[model samples]
Every structure is written in structure tokens, then in C-alpha cells.
Target chain A: MAAIAKSSFRKTKTKNAVLPYLYLLPAFLIMGVITFYPLIYQVIISFTNFETTHLLLGLKSPDLRFIGLQNYIDIFTAALPVENFNFFRVLEFNFWWALSNVILHVPAGVLIATLLNAEGLWFKRIYRAVYILPVVVPPLVVATVWTNIFDERYGAMNQLLTNISAAFLGNADPIYIRWFEDVKPPIPGFLPGAPLTLAYYAMMVANFWLGWPFMSVVATGALQSIPKDLYEAASIDGATPVQQFWGITVPLLRPAMIPAAVYGFTLSFNLFNFVFFMSGGGPARSTELLVTFAYNLVRNLRWYGVAAAFAVIIFGVALIVFLITNRITRATQNYMEA
Target chain B: MAVNPQSTKNMFVRIMNINTSGQTAGRSLPLWKQLVFQLIALIILASVMFPIMYIVTLSFSSITTRPSKLELFPKEISFVAYRQVLDRPTGNPVTFIELLRNSFMLSMGVGAAALVIAVTAAYAFSRFKFKMREVLMILVFIPLLMPAVGLSTPLYLLLNQVQVKECKSGETAILPFTECSDGGKGKLQFNLRDSLLGVGIAMTASALPFAVWNLKGYLDTIPRELEEAAAIDGADANQTFWQIVIPLAVPQLAVTFFLGFIGHWQEFVLTWLFLSQPKDYTLAMTLYNMTGQYANSIPWNRFAAMAVIVALPVAIVYIGLQKQIVGGLTTGGVKG
Candidate 1:
């Protein structure tokens, strides 16, 4: 009788163990329906000539002709027409913008966090709250405010620059720069009387301003968590502040830094609203990133299949970065342990 | 050793020296240096506040003035923009009131649904050890990493097929039901694209991962002993979860609900993609439409008014929930 009861009890326990997975089933099902289905559907659509009109008409199949790698090749090698935008230029701009974001974001985050973490810093809470204000604001509002700041005719930036220039040049009237109006010629002297442009550069400045605050907040939080004793011990050993920062702060902050860098990299790549609202990726297609480019392809041109292809490419790139960062961080942590 | 009357005084002096030495070693720099550092910090703080201050000023400025000439203090304070936004149209106009109603209803629906689903699932994940627990956790992280823009096209395609069912005379029909005819009149059709349900579902999907992640963190921090004690007192798992775990998790639930609510309330891209019809537009989309197609017309004052109206409630809620927001992040960030 005892043996029988024990075996029955074990059976009940085994059944109970499966209950949590049952609870997880609904969420998994929803994710599968929403995320995984679309991912697979997109791959299938990429080979087809799906366009917006066809989508509206509910025409089941679009001649699924296998244009092997033609879309990808066209994206990378396309030329810009005088009146039309080029996909390749957009891709190139995306690469440059993502690289610049990493360059600015990581260093700026570390610098601000370090300043805040300085010894005898007064009213630390006030400064921290102020720094985090931008992160809480809506993206559209941020873009709007930046548009005002970057306005050519009546912007604060231009006004300030003009004043400083007037002071230095000893002139009553200052030369006004039309920041976003100029356009670069295709080739040097090939197109006569063409204007060279810095419109894309101006847009990048706005994006950097919006992105840097979140990076700083994340970095500051991580910096504060680093034990003060570690810095004190290094300083006591006759090390300068810079040496202590490099030796103790940077090494210990790597865990936090890795995550923030990955986030920054992904954000720069996927940033759409700011670019879409502020620059429209123009003066030409010089400021378009992958997200904006894909959006424009779908919304403007209605090339559904090609847009899906771009989306797939973006997903792959983001996945690769995420995986690489994860691997590097894990290895670093293991090395530290050893 | 020879005992001396003055030895006790010397011992007390030695103790005081040790205490003072340690205190001095750890004491931060002098007040003057601290003040200088603070002044530099104050300047940085001012720079951070500048853009927000400019927007607030512009919101109160006259609608007729150019965006560039707008001052920190409006020369003439006027509520023309606000009045225009609030005033009902002379002849059955679809005003900001309707837009707000739509947004509030949609946000609240999505938030409530997400909370119900996430809370139960979070409890299960936190309380039990299961075969696929780790896999489920990792799967939840995928949505966080994937950009919403990437999913827009695919979601559009899938949602296009979803249709409402109708039952009449014991025969189920999907509306607006259509049948192909050769050289004849075809059936009428209805589109789900402009419906609130479509936008709500999308919002819920986007908000789900964050809600689940946060709730799971809170659930983990709840001591298992409480549940076990309840069980010993003859309470079932359902009863224990409802009576004990639910109450304990209220603060976290509130935080997730607000975050999800605000996000959906201000969402643009998905709504823009799905709801192309003008009449179905949300408040944020309506504000966006006021600006030109390329957003170049610069409706400076009117745009600022809309922004202020939208931001006011959010800022108030944020300040009120400041402690919970910080506490939630402190726990969730470290754990996740």
C-alpha cells in the first residue's frame, strides 16, 4: 500500500511540473502568430513581385519569378538620378551615421558619467534628473524642438554663430549660411554651377543631440554603482585621477558599457521618426538610414517585395551586431573571472 | 607597569586621535572646490533644460508669429491656438475631443488586456520551474531587439486577412462577404485597416514584452515563503495567487500599465501605417497631419500648443509616479 501511494504521488508531481509550460503557451502562441509568421512570410514574399496595387486587389499570387539576388545587387550599386533618390547612397550614409553614433555616444556617455561621479560633487540628484529629461520626452517633440534650433532663417544656432562672426570680423552685417539648401554636384565640374551641401551634416547634429542623453543616463547609473573603495585604493597607491579612472573605472564599467553600446548601435540603425520628421533623409538621399529607407520604399514607392527585402537585410544586420556584442561581453566576463 | 592618575586622560586622548584620523581621511574636498564643481554642473543642467524651456515658451507665444522670432517670454500672451484646438466646429466638426476619446479608449483597452495576460504568466514563470522556462525568457527578449519598423509591412499583410464573423440563420458569414461573379455585380467589402481593434492589437503586442519582463522581476522578488505559508493554511494555488501575489504586485502593475498606456497614446508609426482613413486618426496622428507632408510649413505656435496639450498629462503622471518608475527600473534593469 505504501509503495503504491509513493508511486501515485510521484505521478502527480510529474504532471504538476508541466503546468508552467502550459501557462506560457498563450504568450508563445501570440508571438508565433505575430512575429515568427511575418518573418517567414517576408522571406517568401521577397522572391515575388508583390506591389501595393496587387496587395489591394487581393490577387493571391504575383508571378513568383526567382530573381536570384538581383534585388540585393541593385540596392548596393544603384545610381542617383538628378530628380530621383538612390538606394546605394542611403546605405552608405547609414554606415557612416552608425559609425559616428558609436564614436560620439560611447565617449560622451563616459565623460558625463565621470564628471558626475567626481568627488565632492554637490547637488548630484539635480544634475542627474536634468540629464535624464531628454530621455523622457516624446520623440516627435524632440524632433520639433530640434527643427527650430536648426532653422536657417531664425535659428538660435545661426544667430549665435552670426554674432560671434560679427565680433571677430569687425563687421555690422554677418554673412548668413544657408545650411540645408546647398546640393553637391555628382562629379567635380561635370555638372556646372552645382552647389555643394552640408544639409545631411546638419541633420546628424540634431540626431546626436537627441541620442546622447540616454547614453549618459545609462552610463551614470552604471558609474555610480562602481564601488568608491576601488578608486580610493588606486589613488592611495600614488596614481593620478586619470590613471585611476582608466585602470579601475573603465575596466569595471565594461559590463554596463557593452550593453549601452549595443543599444546605441541598434538605435542609430533603426532611428526613423527623427530622420523622417527632420530631414526626410534629404537635401538629397544623403541622410537616409536603413529604417527610413525601408519606410520610404514601402510608403512612397509601394514596392512591397523590395521593402521586405530591405527589412530582412536590416534584421540580419541587427542580429549579427547583437550576437557579436553578446559573445564579446560573455568572453570578457569569463576572462575576468579566470 | 606603574599605574598613573593621568594615564586615563592619555587613553581618552589616544582614542579621540584614532577616530578623528579616520574621519579626516575619508572627508571630501573643501567647500570652495565643491562649489566651483557645482557651478559647472549648473551650466550643464541649464543646457539640458534649454530645449524644453524653448518649447514651453513657444507654446504660449502667438500663433501668427514666425517660429524663429519666438522669445523666451512671449511678448503678447494669447490662447488663440489653445482656443482653436478646443473649440467645437460650427457644423458637426470632428474635434480634438473625439480624438482624445479614441486614444484614451484604445490605450486603456490595450493596457488592461496586457496587464491581465502578463500578470498571470509572470506569476507562473516566477513561481515554477518548467522545461521551457529558459527558452520562453529568451523568446520574450526578441521583440525588444527587433525594431517595430521592420515588422510593419508583415503585420499589415497578416492583419489584412483577419475578418469579423457574422452568424445568421445558423450559417456563419464573414463581412463584408464577397463572391466572385463573371460580368456581374460583386459583393460589397469592408476593411479592418481603419478599425480601433487593429491599432489596439498592434499596441498590445508592442507593450507585452516590457510589461511581462517588469512583472516577472517584481514576482521574483516576492518571497516564496509567503506562498508556501498560504499553502500550509490549506489555500489552493489560485486562491494564494489572487489573495497574496496580486496585492503584493500592485505597484509594479501600476508602473507597467502607465508605461504601456503612454506609449500607445503617443504611438505614430503603426497607427499611420494601418489607419490611412482621415476620420480614424488618433490625437498624435492628427497633430502630425497639421504639419505639412514634409513638415516644412512650420505651424510653429499651433504645433507647440498641440505638443503642450499632449505633454501636460504625461508630465504630471510622470512626476506623480516618479518613485515607482525609479524603483521599477532599479529592480528590472539589474535583474533583466
Candidate 2:
């Protein structure tokens, strides 16, 4: 009797174990083929000298050459065959880009959300409604439209600048600023290695507009979580509004803001379409991001092995960012882990 | 005196405010302060609306070519740009309707495909007490960390393998060989990597993880007692899942599908990389193409019109489903 019960129990256990994997099979099969396979394949190709020429037979071509760590070394040493490519400069600029975006966006988001959170504000719904517009507009669209706006000739940006110049400075040569093509970094040596071109400034302005709304969404979520009585109590204690804000609101928003900043760091670190589409990495790849560089290595450059190695390096950078951010914020910890 | 039930209920409502996106009435600010807040909001809104208004205005103008003036609103509302856009979106042989159809099919097909697969997997995650659950979940989600564009190279090579090549024997052989030992090496007949079908297949990979993650979270909320009760009433496990869990999870399924659908709709990189033919060009692909072309050749008004058209579906969906969409996004930890 004991043996029979144990067998049945074991049978049930085995059955239950198989069911989840069975359910997971279809999703994972597609994922394995499409996502996981490519990732694994990328890591493998990073060591080999894979290019478009070898694309026909991939890994098995008679002409395919294997050069272990050469691709990685080239990238690190800035010895890449492609012109105007430096790994460190791009990486540094990536960090700065993310940091600058966060500095501007987080405060603006928190401030706006806080104002909206102030008990009863008129048209609060409308204000929040407008916030969704940016969220709905994909980064690709945002980049494209902003590029149009900043056009040197017929762009609204030059027009606006011309209009402003005529109004204030009393001189306007159509305010034709080559926002994208002009690679002369306005602030030379400002961001060492990476040139902060006029395109960078334009991207910043556009990204700021694209960015703050999402941050505001996140900040609003945090703001709603703050107990209202804390504010009321501060008011009763004769604390000034500014005092209340700094003391109560800032501390409360820290938990959300830190994680948000971290996530934004990684997002902007790898932000491809916005930077790429804006000016095609800004004239000779001066404004090229790591991801876009990887993209170009494949699409335009056709240096497949170099692209794979670059992608692996990027993956490493992302992993490190994720790990460090995950440690600091534990933001990605799902409910079970938390 | 006991704690008032009404006040407790109010507290609960306030606590759940994040769910309703905090639209409930809290204590009103000072009237003057409220006015100040209003002023700030108006300024912010104006700034956000600046570029959007330009695109809308430009799309409606009588000018077929790119406008050279700073017109925030249309001087005369003409439908010519819209008509031309609808008629001929770009220099490509494909029509606006064809582009729409391609985009619609891909998004909807991928959305539905991911949904079906994800629901089953999410149900497993929610219901099963499996050993590898945590590890599996992490593995599924970790791909999102890698910049999607980074994965394009491998996907490019992998999908490139599935093609039909003609042999020296004047026969077509469909094989999964990147290095083809051909029945024929002369004519390349069908290449999966360059087709719309292959593009959809590749996109579904990126879409699946998000789908699984979103549905898993929703599925966890469903009480197991319903399934238990169904089991007690002689329902099988499969029956309980289909009849019980799915119905409860329908709204969430819609949420997951739409969220993934939005991304799929705007997907540019993989589609552009994979597809070469104009017939497979999505709205986003075409939009990016217009921007890449020579400045003089680009029909700027039509570009603006297409921009409006592309943005319309997303805006309308978001406007219609803000509460559900917003709630879903925040809970799922939005990408970007």
C-alpha cells in the first residue's frame, strides 16, 4: 500500500513538472529560434572574422576566417577598419547623454507631477492627457519630426531662430544653422573624445521633450503613493511650502526616482532610433551611439564580425549597467525576489 | 468610537489611487496656488504640443511640396496632402493602403500569435509549482536588457539560412543550409529572410518575451480557488484552464496584446534590415526612408501627412484606453 501511494505521488510530481515546460515549450521554441539563438550566435561570431561575404554559408564558408579576440581588440584599441569610430568616446558620451537627460527630466517630471498631485488642480485630467501624446509617439517618429523641425533651409527651427533674431538682435540671415551637418562641437573639449555637435544639442532638446512626459508619468505614480496627511501635518507645523516640498516630497520620491534614473540611464545608453534617425549618427558618426554603431557595422559598414564583437561588448556594457543598477536600486527585482 | 467604515473605505480608495491614476479628489490646494499650477501646466502643454501642431498643420496645407514658412496652423485646410499620401505615400511602387495592410497584418498577426502562446505559458507560470520557475522567468525577461538593435545581426544571419536555391539540375531545392549543396545553384527562387513572413517571424521573437511577462503578472492575480472549484465539479486541468483561467484573464490578454501591438506597429529596425522589397515596407520603414532620401526630392508635406497618419492610430488607441494602458505600463515596468 505504501509503495503504491509513493509511486502515485511520484507520478503526479513528474506530470506536474512536465506540464509547465510543455506550456513554456511553444513560446521558448520561437524565442530560442529568434531571440536566444541570435544572441548565442552573436557571441560565437564575435571571435570570428564574419562579414557580408561569408553571410551566404555563415560559419561554414571555405573563405570564412576565424580570428579570436581580434575583433574585440580592434574595438578596444580604436583600430576598427571603419572611420571615425572610437569605443571609449562613444561609451563616455552614452553615459553623459543618459545622465544629462535624467538631470533635466526627473526634476521636471517630479515638479509637474507634484503640482498636479496638489489636492485639486483644474484641468488636471487634460494636463495628464497631453502627457500621453509623447508616450504614444514612438521614438522613431519623434526623431523624424524633430529632424524636420530642425531643418536648416525649410525647417521650423531655423525659421523660429530667424524670427527670434529679427525680433531681438535685429539681424537675421535666415538663421541658417547647420544643426546636423556642422560637426564642429560648439563646446570643444567639453565632452572629451566625443564631440557634442549642434546635432547633439538638437537631439537633447527633442529628447527632453520626448523624455519628461514619461518621467512625469513615473513621478506621478510615486507622488500618488505619498500620504496626503504628511503634507497636511507639515502645513500645521507652520512649515513653508518650499520647506514641505524639500523635506517631505523629495525624500518620498527618492525610491522611485533612483530606479527611474537607473532605467533611463540604460535606455538612453542604448537609444538607437532617436540618435540614428535624427542625423544618421550626425555627420561621419560623431554622434554615433554604441547600438547604432553595431547597427551600422552590419547595415552600412557590412563588417559582420566587427559588428558581432561590438554587439557583444555592448551586451557586456548593458549587463554591467543592469547588474550595477540592479544592485543599487534592485529595481528589476520581481515580487518574489523583493 | 470605532474607526469609521466610510473613512476606512476612503483610505482604501486613496491607497488604490494609483490604479485609477490618481484622478480622485484630494484636498484642493489654495485657489491662488491652483491658478499658478494651472499656468505651469498650460506652459508645459504648449511646449509638448509645439511640434505636434506643426505636423498637423503642414499635413492640411494646399502645398504639395515642402512648406518654407513657419505656419503653426493651416492657412487653408486642404485635403490634397492627405489625398496624395493615401494615393501615393512614397516613390516606391507600393500604395498607402498596401503599407497600412502590411503593418496591420504584422502587428495583429504577431500580437495574436504572441497572445495565444503567452496565455498558455502565463497560465503555467501562474498555476504550476515548478522547480525552474524563477530561473525560467528571469531567462525570458533578460533579453529585454540587450538593446533590440544589437540582436539584429544574429537574427539576420539565422533567418538568411531558410531560402530556396536552384541546382545545376534545373530543380529548386528548399533546404535549411546556409552553405547550399544545391539541386540547383543558378536561380535563387524564395528567400524567407527577405519576405514579410520572415519579418513577422523575427518580430515575434522580441514580442514574445514582453507578452509572456505581461500575461504572467496578470495570470498570477487570478485566484486558484476557481480552478479548484472547477476541479471539484469534475473539470479536467485543461478544461479548468480554458474555461476558468482564460475568461478571467481576457481583459489582461487585450492589454498585453495592445501593448505589444503598439511596439510591433512602430517596429522599424528589424523590418528594415530583413526586408529589401518595397512591398514589405512598413509605415515606419517608409517614414525613415523618406527622411534618408535627398532633401530636394522629399515631398515634405506628404511626409508630414504620413506622419500624422502613422501617429493617428496610436494616439486614438491611447486616448481611448488611457486607464488600462497606463495601468498596464506602470505595473509591467515600461520599456524606455
Candidate 3:
């Protein structure tokens, strides 16, 4: 019996050693084709001055000479010609937009989830589903819907705003705000300050509407997973509802919060559909994101090498953000678990 | 530890009396408060559905009326805009039949392919404990983070090279050959740009990450004991997976499949990016085209009509599959 058991154990060990690799074969192959190959190919193309004309003429030969780091240098410091649009300006907007997305997404999600999780909240599922409706809707459809809503003349939003102003301020002279128009107007109630362009702000509103639901859903899930006993104990110890939330809920929910926050930030950085469909990086390129800017360079303007450099920059930023957040969260996890 | 019977009866009566009085006091709260909450909820719901309602109403309204005046209900009903969008002439005049065929075929192909690849990959990730397993798991998310813009140039170049080869051999090129085949005329002989296959592949690549991640989460929740029990009963690993695991995961499989289908059905970026020719546009792309440049050239009524037609099928599918979607989310949420 002992001899037979030993033989079975040896057989199992051998099977286990081979099984993992065998199972991983298909995943690795798919990843290689879909992800790694394109990645390597993109890095290679960044070295060359490949463009639409070159591609069309079958000039993408291996014999093309490499220009070392010129593309990267040009991307950072290169100024646009008088006839051409500035590329760095687009990158700057993308950075600000992504930062703002994190600011809005995380808190909005937390607040909504907390409200829903409160005791005596009725019709929870209905509200949750209603909130998440935008997420299920296709990005194109969302963009199309908002385009009409923000229309200068026929838009529902403008009409509603006009009505409200008329009722409250008695000024109803068919007020129409071109949400995406780049023209600046004087600030109301701010000491006659210079007017600011709202093109980027309008796009951000549409994006915020599209993105907030995802954060809320994630936060709600995280909130539900917390143990009820902890809240009960807090209540017994004479903790106020607000105090319990800050002390127990926030700290306990961090594990889920960190990941959701990182996702929101990364998603904002790579946001393409919202900017593309709503603003089209229009009104003097005020709303162009890094991704959209890169796309315009390659697909529209035929500047392949420059676009590749921009892509590399975007990737680098994303990786740095991801790593820093990952390290912080992992450390927090260790602390909590310990 | 034994209690006195008389004391127990008295305690129960006291509890009942307290509960009845508390219920009465709760009932004394103003009915207006409940009405106020309901009113607030209704307003929120309306806000959520307002855009869709606007599109629906405008779709049925007359073109003579300005779009700004369009309300929740059409003043007069007409299908003129729908007819126009359906019969609108392209340079090459693509028919409604062709558009539907392209969109349906792309969605189905991509959905099917994604299901197969994601299921296998997810199963492997969930069941196996291997070296670099965690690293491989993270690798699955790379495509999600890597925006499509970054991949477009290389893909275009690669496809262009392949097209050149086909043109040189005097065979019908499989891709949109921008230069070699058309003698630099910028016209493709056999444009893969508008082909269902190309669109499907791009959609599949984009949707794979989410599908894999979701499926892996589902597979993890299933107990290992079931598989071990099957093995004890002389079942092979494959048999166990097919008979036991797959059967139990049917609901999840359905949800994933529907999500992939809907996602591909409404996909615009990839379809627009790959298929540049007007003749090869999908339904979403077609709807976008109806709005025209500067977004005002096309009459608002006609644009709304086109949007309605485009969104109707998706809305129906969403409502039909609403239960599955909600169930999947709730289950996945709690489990994760």
C-alpha cells in the first residue's frame, strides 16, 4: 500500500508540472498576437518616419534607417509651425482632464454608494439600475444623445436653462450657449472677469455622465461586502453615523477604493470616444486628449513617428501612475492584514 | 438556566405591546413625506430616460417642425425621415440590406470568437496555479489600457503590406489597398476596411479583456471540490469541466455572451477607423453619417429618426436581457 501511494504521488507531481504550461498555451498565443506583437511593432515604427503616404506606396521596408530618440525629443520640445496645430497643448489638456476625472469619479461614487447603503433606503435595485443605464448604453449612442442635448438652437438643455433664467432672473431673450464653442464670455457674478471657453468643460460634463455610473457600481459592491457586525459594534459604542462612516467604512473600503480609483484615472487618460464624438477636439483643439491627439497625428495628419512618440509618452505616464498607486495600495494591504 | 413560565408569558406580552405601539407611531408620520420621496425618485428616473425619450419623440415628428419644440410626444407622426435614411444614396449607394448584414455578421462573428478564446483562457487562469500566474493575469489587462490609437498605425502598415502582396500577385486583395491596386488613386479594389471580418476582429480584441476578467471572476467562485469529486468518480479533467463546470456556469456564459454581442453591435470607433469607405458603414456609422458635418446640415428630425431606428433594436435587446444583466451584476458584485 505504501509503495502504491508513493507511485501515485510521483505521477501527480509530474502531471501538475506539465498541466499549467499546457493550459497557458492558448492564452499566451492570443496575448502574443493581440498585444505583444503590436507593442513591439509600435516601438519599431516609432524609430522610422513612417506615414500614410509611405504606407500606401509600400515603402514600409525593413531597410528603412532608424533615427535614434529624435522622435521622442521632438515630441517634448517641438513647436508647431504657424500653419500646423500645437500637439503639446493637446497632451496638457489630456493631463488636466484625467486629473479632474479622478477628482469627480471617486467622491461621487463614494457618496452615492453610501446613500444607497444607508438603513431604510427603499427601492435600492431600481435606483442602482437607473444609475447604471448610461454604462450599458454604447459610447457612440451616449455621444449622439448628448450632441442633441447641447445643441445651440434645438437643444433641450439650452431651452431648459433659458426657461429657468426667465423664471428666476426675468431675462428670456432666447438665450443660447454654444457649449462646444471656443469663444470666451465674461463671467457672471465675478466682477466682470474675462470670459472662458467652455468647450473642454462641456466635453468633461458628457464624459462625467458616462463614467460616474461605473465608479458608483464598483463602490456599491465594495460597500456591501463590509461586515454588518462592525457597524453594529460602532453604533453600540455611541458613535455618530458620520463618525462611523469616516472611521469604519472609509478605511475598510480602501482595498476596493484604490483599485476603482486607479481604473477611473487610467480610463480618463485613455478616454477617446467622449472627446471624439462630442467635441472632435474642436474649437481650436481645446478638447483634444492624448489618445485623440495621437489618432489625429497618425490617421488625419499622417505623422506616424510623432504619433508613436506621443503614444509612448501616454504609456509611460499610465505605467508610472499604475505602479505608484499599486505600491501604495499594496503597502496599505500589508498594514491592514498584519 | 430554567425560566419561570409566568415570567416568560409576561415578557412576551410586554414585547408584543411595545411592537404594536411602535408600529402605530410609525404610521402617524405624514403621508406627504412618502409622496415627496416618490416624487423625487420619479424626477430622477425621468432625467435618466429623457434623452432616449427625446430621440423617440423626434423620430416620429414631422420635418416641417423645428426640433427644439419637439416634446415627449410627437404632434404629428411620419416615417419620412426613416425612409430617407434607409434609402439615402451613398456615392456607391449601400442598401439597408447590406448595412444590416454587415452589422449583424460582425457582431455575431466577434461575439462567437470572443466567447471561445475568453472562456478557455479564463478557465485556465482560474483552475491552474502556476509560476507567473499573477503576472499573466495582469497581462490580460494590457489591451484594456493600451488605447486603440496606439495600435492603429502599426496595424494599418501591416495590413497595407499584405494588400500590396495580393495586388502584385494579380489576386483579388483582401484589404483596402490604398495605393498599389488602385494605382495610387486612393480607391480599394476589395476593401477589407468595410468587411465584417475586419470589424469583428477589432471588436473582439477590444472586448476580450473585460470578458476574460469577468469570466475568471465567475470561475473562481465555483468550488474545487466538485472537480475533485468528479475525478474520484473516474472522470477526466476535460469531462469534469464540460459536464460539471460548464453546466453550472451557464447563466454567467449567457450574460457574457450578451454583453459582447451588445458591445459589438454598438461599436463605432473600430468600425469607423477600419472601414473608411462610405459603402461599408455599419448601422452606428450610418446613423452618425445622417447627422452630417457640423451636425446641423441634416435636418434634426431626420437625424432623430435615424437615431431611433439605430437605437430601437439595442433598446429592445437590453430590456429583454435586463434580468440577466442585473442578476449577473449583483452576483458578480457581491462575490468580488
Q: After superposition, how far is residue B227 of candidate 3 from its true place, in Å?
A: 1.3
Candidate 1 wrong stretches, greater than 4 Å = A1-11, A56-92, A118-126, A166-178, A184-200, A227-235, A332-338, B1-39, B68-70, B88-93, B123-143, B162-190, B217-223, B228-240, B290-298, B319-336
Put down candidate 1 lDDT per residue, A20-111, tens digits, no spaces: 76666676676676666776777776665677655643326454455666666556566312244565556656666776777787887788
- For candidate 2, lDDT tens digit of each residue in B1-336? 011234344433332232343445656678888788788889898888889988889888877667667888778888888898799888889998899999999988999998987778877877887888889888888787777778888888878877887777766667564434553356677788898888888878778887888888888777889899998897767888889888888888887888777878888888878899999899988888767435467678888888888888876666555556665655565332
DockQ of each: 0.23, 0.47, 0.24
Sort candidate 1 into its docking category.
Answer: incorrect
* DockQ-based CAPRI category assigned to the predicted complex of candidate 2: acceptable
In model 2, which residue pairs have backbone atoms overlapping below 3 Å? B166-B184, B166-B185, B167-B183, B167-B184, B167-B185, B168-B184
Give a tens-digit lDDT track for model 1, residues B230-254: 9899776778889999998888888
- Residues A303-332, model 3: lDDT tens digits: 776677777777776667667766766776
**lDDT for position A231 in model 2:** 84
Q: Which sequence of candidate numbers ranks them by lDDT, best first?
A: 2, 3, 1
Which pairs clash in the backbone of model 3?
Answer: A185-A195
The interface RMSD values of the models, given in order, are 8.0, 4.4, 7.4
Give lDDT per model, in order. Answer: 0.66, 0.79, 0.67
Collision pairs in model 1: none
Most DockQ-accurate candidate: 2
